[model samples]
Target: MREGKRLGRVIWAPVGAAVLSGLVIGAAARLLMRGIALAVGGLTGMSLAGTVGILVVFVVLALPAAVTATARPVIMHAGRWVTAALTGLMAARTGVSDAKIIVLADDGQLTPITVLIVAFAAIVVLHGRLAQYLTRRLRTLPESPAEVLPTPDARPV
Candidate 1:
């Protein structure tokens, strides 16, 4: 791959890691939600079917984490984009249903935009090392004066 692409990889590493973290958090949230659902379902006397439903929820909840681990960069980028859109969409409304209108009005303090900015910042910060890894520098070979290859221009016509 070209150095340029590798450069992006280096830049995106931290973002990818953060994305993975986000996926983990999301999975945790889903797990909790499913657990709650199962408990409620059981209390309602929903039976083994209710517990089976929770198991299904667990499977669904685990998918994002698995996907993010495999493709964290893409996930991070998508999340950044989606969060930005959601923030913008939320910003345009007046007398919103939310009790926290200021959160939407603000650029990112409470918005998903915060995640985007952070991921972008992370990518820019660590891009160099990533680029180096992707496009590793040519190794220097020890040589005597005679070991050097003659330049084309230095050769006799």
Candidate 2:
């Protein structure tokens, strides 16, 4: 029973992280889509924004699954690729969103792909360690404490 419970805890950690990350990343992607829609200024822009935002959400959700599955040494190298992909997507999404603001400031147009490329380069070059931080943190969390109960003598009759 204890082992089963332990297995459940192990399973719950990754599942819970994935759900929470989904909600958070989903909101951020929505905001980015809104920014893209505003920047592109048409129905076509809304379509593109929706596509990119959905892709981002899907990519972010995949991170937790990747981390959970790659926890063992059998395919350890795959973990690095997963981390890199997640980080790159995060940076690209952020860059596109930031570019929207920059375009507004300059009163000019900018392509999302251009900003995505620049952000990917910048993040890989400057913040290489940011990848997997959240997933790693979740993976290392301590298990819950054991339960305690009162003895029969201590219980009310």
Candidate 3:
């Protein structure tokens, strides 16, 4: 029983961390997508409601991608499932049935999946690089001695 409890504790911490990180990344991605949608909609003279719907659609599609791209493998796989479910719900709510949008092209023609693949690849690479940089920076910080450690005069005889 004790061993089982210990194992549960060890397992739960990483799972909890992954979930928390996924939620945070999802929210950040939603905000970023919302801002981008708002800017594009404004430039193209889309209606306010239309812009909001665009943002909603972006959030639905991008959140999971961002989380999966940035998170650990287990979380990444789970994020795909979560994304599919949310895409359905958001599509229903926003009246945007299709989640796929082709935005990039070459030779004056639209390239079906190339743009999306590149964008996701860029996002994943950027996220991974940023995480590595932050981890390296954190590792290089000097550790301070604990206050509980005995000083020369405080040492036991």
Candidate 4:
């Protein structure tokens, strides 16, 4: 009922933040890289459409881990920022490299950026699952019994 809805919100909120952060990171990275590419020459590996596609893919790749990681309150509130930043960096770097590799492949200069992306995505997904598992285990663990301490009175002394 209300608890379920509250739990849902807690889980979903970080996911929303991840989506937002992904979009922002992707757009910013694209803009910065585009500027650098243009400055070097008439070079631009990824088009606007490619940037959009990569951003979409990045969001998809990030969602699973984001969901699992958000299960913890501290992670949902604070750790999400760190996760977002790291994931964003990984996405941006991989996106740029992938685009460059695609351009190279077009000219018969093929490279394997897909493997890099796959590996990175796998790490993110696995890490999230591990965090969720650890949290669940901790929650299920029994607390140790407290020992009773006797107070000494003057008579006892």
Candidate 5:
């Protein structure tokens, strides 16, 4: 029982981090989307603004995922999973009637949960690929020495 408790605590670190990161990132994404929408709408027109804003948000959000994927793929994967879960929870909390919106007539509509799932999947794939490419590129580059060898006179006592 004690061992099980210890294992549970160890497992919870990544799980907690994933959930916290997801919640924070989701809120940031929403705010970014909203701000972009308002700015674009005011500058251009409503219809185009909505489309452009969403595109911008997706692109912008993907960048961090790509970076995190490179630095820590596990964290990125966990974050994506948590994001999807949170989206579902939020949708349920809001009630079914208000959870979905029509994006296109013939193409079909999507709920917030669906959008988040799609976005998270896209981010994971894109970031994973980008990270791989970057790693390859880095490997091909010549290594630089960390520092000049310490001179005999300069050596510490």
Candidate 6:
């Protein structure tokens, strides 16, 4: 319902929040995936062939997912920033200024157990959304001719 109407600089609040949240989720997801792998593989004990297979599956599942999950909000925020910057409105500052320091201090910490719980939840949610988004995005991409399997090498399409 609130998609339309700039409502002034308040727009940045949501946009900035999403991007920051997304980056946090991405880092968390990668760490979680790595931890899962380490637990299942024990850091050094899985057989080479099995480890390779697991790794291939992990890459197929995780990398694109993490990227898309983290990228959507970033792209949206960039669009907002670009438009606002051009319109002589507020601009995003990527500096270690006092305000940034305050924001970081405020947002970067919590009770340790609460931090772990929230971080785990964020990563899992982002992973699910990322997988869905990436699957849809991949489906929308054009298939390359090379990806088409030849008909038994006996017939050409």
For each candidate, the alpha-carbon lDDT, in order, equals 0.38, 0.51, 0.43, 0.51, 0.42, 0.39
**In candidate 2, how many Å is residue 54 off?**
4.0
lDDT of 1 at 43: 29
RMSD of each: 15.6, 7.5, 9.5, 11.7, 12.4, 17.4
TM-score of structure candidate 5: 0.29
Quote model 2's TM-score.
0.48
What are the TM-scores, per candidate, against the unseen true structure? 0.24, 0.48, 0.33, 0.43, 0.29, 0.27
Error of 1 at 59 (Å): 16
Question: Stretches of candidate 2 above 4 Å error?
Answer: 43-60, 63-66, 69-77, 83-107, 111-136, 139-157
Rank ordering of all candidates by TM-score, starting from the highest: 2, 4, 3, 5, 6, 1
What does candidate 2's lDDT look like per residue over 63-91, in tens digits? Answer: 54435443665443455455456655765
Give the per-residue lDDT digits (tens) of candidate 3, residues 79-139: 6556545544543443232222223223333332334334433443333233333333433
Q: Write the per-residue lDDT of candidate 4 for residues 1-157, one digit (tens) a residue.
A: 8577556555555556446545654565456556444433436788778889856755554554455553567654344445545555665676676475355443222223344345445544443344344434443433333323443553374
What number of clashing residue pairs does each candidate have, in the order they appear? Answer: 4, 0, 0, 0, 0, 0
lDDT of model 6 at position 146: 56
Off by over 4 Å in 1: 1-6, 42-157
Q: What is the lDDT of candidate 5?
A: 0.42
Candidate 1 clashing pairs?
10-127, 10-130, 11-123, 11-127
- Screening candidate 3 with a backbone cut-off below 3 angstroms (N, C-alpha, C), the clashing residue pairs are none
Q: Whole-model lDDT, candidate 2?
A: 0.51
Better of 2 and 6 by TM-score: 2
Q: lDDT tens string, model 5, 1-157? A: 8577556544443334333344444445454334433432323233566555543433343333333433466866654444344444443443333323322212322344356445544543443344334433443333335334656788789
